[model samples]
Target: MEVLVNNKLYAVQQGITIAALLQFIQLSAHKGIAVAVNNQVVPKTAWDQQQVEPADNITIIRATQGG
Candidate 1:
């Protein structure tokens, strides 16, 4: 299956969870990170239960601190 992550195309396993996608892309699951699926913000507590579907528009963002 394929999904768009941050406007980029990514091929992932079928029924890939949000948590798994983060791991597949080598991103650490920590603070300052946020994920939204199809314009809906998914809570961190539900990442493991959120399953990504084909053609799903996923946006992964990180909070940066700067003066």
Candidate 2:
């Protein structure tokens, strides 16, 4: 299946969860991060339960240490 991630198209295996997607992208879950699917914010608790679909738009934001 293909999904739009941060405005870029990516091909991923079916039945992958948000948590897995993060891992696949080599993002650390320990860091504070935010995720939005189809323009709706998805809570961290739902990452494991949320399933990504083809053509789905996913946005991920992380807190940066800078002033």
Candidate 3:
């Protein structure tokens, strides 16, 4: 299956969860991050349950320490 992540197309396995996707892309889940699917913010508690569908739009925003 393919999904649009941050406007880029990525091929991922079907039934992949947000948590798995993050790991697949080598993102640091330990850090503060925000995930949104199809314009809806997905709470951290739901990452393990949020499944990515084909053509779904996923946005990952990681917190930065600059001000």
Candidate 4:
């Protein structure tokens, strides 16, 4: 399956959940990241239940601390 991450296309295994995808990208769930799939924001509670399909557009945003 092919999914877009941060505007880049990546090949991932079938039946991959959003949580799994985050791990594959080497991103920590503790980073306070937000995810939107196909233009809809997915809540953290739904990450484990959300399955990503081929051609799905996934956008991940992380919060940064600055002064």
Best by the TM-score measure: 1
Candidate 3, residues 5-55, lDDT tens digits: the string is 898899999999999999988884547889999999999999889899999
Candidate 3 — worst ten consecutive residues by lDDT sum? 24-33
Instruction: List runs of model 2 lying over 4 Å from the truth.
Output: none
RMSD in Å for all candidates: 0.8, 1.0, 1.0, 0.9
Count of clashes, each model = 0, 0, 0, 0
Model 1: residue 21 alpha-carbon error in angstroms: 0.3
The window of 10 residues in a row where model 4 has the poorest summed lDDT is 23-32
Worst 10 residues of 1 by lDDT: 23-32
Candidate 4 yields a Cα-based lDDT of 0.92
The runs of at least 3 residues in candidate 3 whose Cα sits more than 4 Å from the true structure, single-residue gaps closed, are none
- lDDT tens per residue, model 1, 1-67: 8899999999999998999999999886557999999999999999989899999999999999999
TM-score versus the correct structure, for each prediction? 0.94, 0.92, 0.93, 0.93
TM value for model 3: 0.93
Off by over 4 Å in 4: none
Q: What's the residue-level lDDT of 31 in candidate 3?
A: 71
**Number of colliding residue pairs in model 2:** 0
- Deviation of model 4 at 36, angstroms: 0.2
Of the two candidates 1 and 4, the one with more favorable TM-score, higher being better, is 1
Q: Which portions of model 1 show Cα errors greater than 4 Å?
A: none
